[model samples]
Target: MSIRTVLLHAAPDSGFNDRLAFAVALARQSGAAIKGLYTLYPAGVPRVGRALSIYVNELVREAKEKEGGLKAQFEQATAAAGLAASWETIEGEVASSLREAVAFADITVVSETPYGTVDDQLAATLPEHLAMACNGPVAVVPTGKPVPARIGKVLIAWKPSREAGHAVRFALPVLAAADEVEVFTVEEGDTTTADSGAKLAAWLATHGVNAKHRHVAEGNAGHAITNEVQKFGADLLVMGAYSRSRFAEMVLGGVTASLLVDPPVALLIAH
Candidate 1:
């Protein structure tokens, strides 16, 4: 029920160090063990020609080298943090490997993708996929920036949906630790009840979380959510990922898309 194990998608990329640092910090805060997962696609066995076989062999060798380096880095970082940690190198599809790794994890920590980079797009979308596939929270940290040492304040994007409810439940540990917790709801005309936000706040209170209810006139949901994060100086933003179908989200962007495109703060997302 608490954050006992944190799974990190450890990639040998430009943002590897940042992700490790952030994950270690969070693990320290929660007294959680860290598991670093490095996944690489195995080059398929070649049967047609020796030339193709040689190329595949070279790719596999390069992948193994990368994994070795990443493993060393993970060990060094975890040792420096004095944290209980484990590392795994798997040959499989990145998304599926992460989904399997996160099955036993209480939370997953990942770095945001570098914008407009084809190679980093997968890294960017990995958190979203994990949020949907894993039965826990996923913390997406912005790359190339120092993460907040402590998540003192949290902004929860509250909505009356099963996904939103799940996100709140998954993020309870972080919320419980925050000095200030705000349940932010965007009201669209007369559709939502005036006391809806209060109800969520009361629910959180039962779990020993003191949260304030804040409702704003419905504008762009994503903008409203991020605006609140900036206005309140929140270190963390908790919300459900992809409330709508992927196709629908692609056509008409949702809160998840907006935040992923330009994350304002560390995001704890669940689905």
Candidate 2:
């Protein structure tokens, strides 16, 4: 699908300046518009609607101030990138609104935070919950670095599975722009030991990406992907965020958890 609009989710504590920049970069390239959305976290209990009304007003007031400041900074950054990005504020759960935004746009852009960051608590777009929504491909921009306009290599954590396939599909734009696209999978003992690597490569070729299949017989799947990502000097790593359970890592622990901060490469996640 063509990208005519992009939804960039923002909140009071979003620490993803780099992600905002990346979305602006992509928007400029695609002649698309960027909408920066901020959601206010309601105060007090849901059951006591009346009791929370006054406190809710206070929360909304503070949120408005935060949004004003954030909107200014966001506009300045996007303007510097020569793209038209605008802001809007909403009141609701961050994750639900983000999903709605994704459904309404061509693609979704988010900046992932460390598993336990304050922003994660506010927006809860932390990789796991995000991957679970399954609304659209999400570009999880890494913090602490500048977003690159172009990438040299692309890493696809593949396994001939839905998640892997989705990752490839989600990364179509970035993959097409890279010099090299590599599909890599690691053995996990029991199931998925087939020659699916070649199959994944073929899938990539159909999408105009000449991906090379590479299989690693040993090492942790996430670790292997990271090592190869670094080895290839890949600018982007695309992989499915397998699970988004509160108990699972996407929100709390596993692979998504490990890659939250200073990942080997910027991750583009979809479920």
Candidate 3:
């Protein structure tokens, strides 16, 4: 019932070190082994096209030095955390190596890519990036402040759909870890008519979770869920990452899209 191994994708810059330390601390608490995965792309691609930057070598020497420093820092962090950790430098084709690493470990946390659109691209390309990989659930931790600890209060965004079901299942560990598990369902379609929340509550009872069902009527599901989380003092959220047809998202953003941009609580999503 504990996280045994965690796979963390390290980044080019040192910003990722803080994330790694947090992961290491959690792993230590859970008696999990930490796997340090490094993606080694060709040092310093020409920033501009050959016409503009052929003469500019991009100072690859700086990249080389940075990479070395990063590795040393990773080792130091691992040692400081007092947990088992290993390092692997992969000849990366970017997302491909990440998929492989996620598949190789029990739990995966990806460092956000610097393409200026990783969050948007994450929803679009996650399937391809994961590629039927990852035997266990993965955590795509967005680059920001470190996730808070003592995750006792959790809000489950529930809907009668396969996506929502998978989200709940994938978040079983976290839910089991929480002291308060709120099954927050917003009005959508005939959800209340069919007593969808009751079914979910029964299922959770079978699994020994005393989850409370809260039905929110007449509001946006995403916003309602966020408000409910705040009302209940929830620290973590369990939700499904839903992808709409590219056209639908553009015309009017869906709950998933809105949540991705600004989730009130730390989210654990299953797509």
Candidate 4:
């Protein structure tokens, strides 16, 4: 499906501009409108005493002030790019707010790590949380990097699972627009894996994606995929997100968990 509405997390952190850049590029490619979501967390204050209440109120005031600047920046950027844009402000938990906003978006954009101060531990894994919580695709931009102006080469991390299939289907729009697309799979001496990769590539061809299939025998799937992303110099990496149970993935340390922590490039993922 073509992207029509892009939901972007607008904040005052370092990744805000990068995330916006990525969102603008994607929206431009698909002729989509952008919606900037600015979230406030006045609920995080504890009702311990009056001193803390006053401190929390001051912090909220400062955050609100920052929101004004961020809104201006968003408008200027989107307007300069000639894209239709809108603004929003929500007061609550960031994850909960995004959960509702993503429902109306074709794709949601966010930073791979926390969007606030470095000590904001609650949001350290916001991207992963949204990836699992949302029903649609999430495009996560790398933190503190210059986002690519266009998605030229896309690398798809393939696996024979429903989540991977969903990711491929959700990423069809970007894949079709990419100049080069590769379906890369890491196998352990499994011939069937190679055959499946070829079939997936052929099927993608029917959807107007010229994808090349590649398979390698590697035991560490997470490391292998990240290394391939760097080797290929890919602009974007499309892959399935959270193929395992959250508790199991947390304890076992799967690929989705590792990559979401520190993505080497822009990532488009779905559950």
Among the numbered candidates, top lDDT falls to 4
Candidate 3 off by > 4 Å: 13-18, 42-63, 111-136, 243-247
**lDDT, candidate 1, 11-84, per-residue tens:** 76666787787788788888899999887653224336889768656655776788887898889888988899
* Candidate scoring better on lDDT of 3 and 4: 4
lDDT of 4: 0.86
- Candidate 2 lDDT, 61-111, residue by residue in tens: 887787877788788977887776778787875676676677777777777
TM-score ranking of the models: 4, 1, 2, 3
In TM-score terms, candidate 3 sits at 0.76
Candidate 2 local lDDT, residue 114: 56
- The digit string of per-residue lDDT tens for model 3 on 1-271 reads 4577888766564337545755665576567788877655432333467853543333233434566777788788778777788877765544567666665565676533334553334334443245234444555444564565556787888877766677688666667666888888777665462378768877887877888888866687777887897799876677766644534754787876666555565566665
Give the 10-residue window scoring lowest on summed lDDT in candidate 2.
41-50
Q: Report lDDT (CA) for all predictions.
A: 0.81, 0.71, 0.63, 0.86
**What are the per-residue Cα lDDT tens digits for candidate 4 across 80-187?**
999999999987657788989999999999987744564245467778888888899999998876688889999999988788898899899999999999999989
Clashes of each: 0, 3, 0, 0
What TM-score does structure 1 among the candidates reach? 0.89
Candidate 1 at 267: error in angstroms? 1.1
TM-score preference between candidates 1 and 3, better one: 1
For each candidate in turn, give its C-alpha RMSD to the true structure in angstroms: 3.0, 3.3, 4.4, 2.2
TM-score of each model, paired residue for residue = 0.89, 0.83, 0.76, 0.92
Candidate 1: pairs in clash:
none
Give model 2's TM-score versus the native structure: 0.83
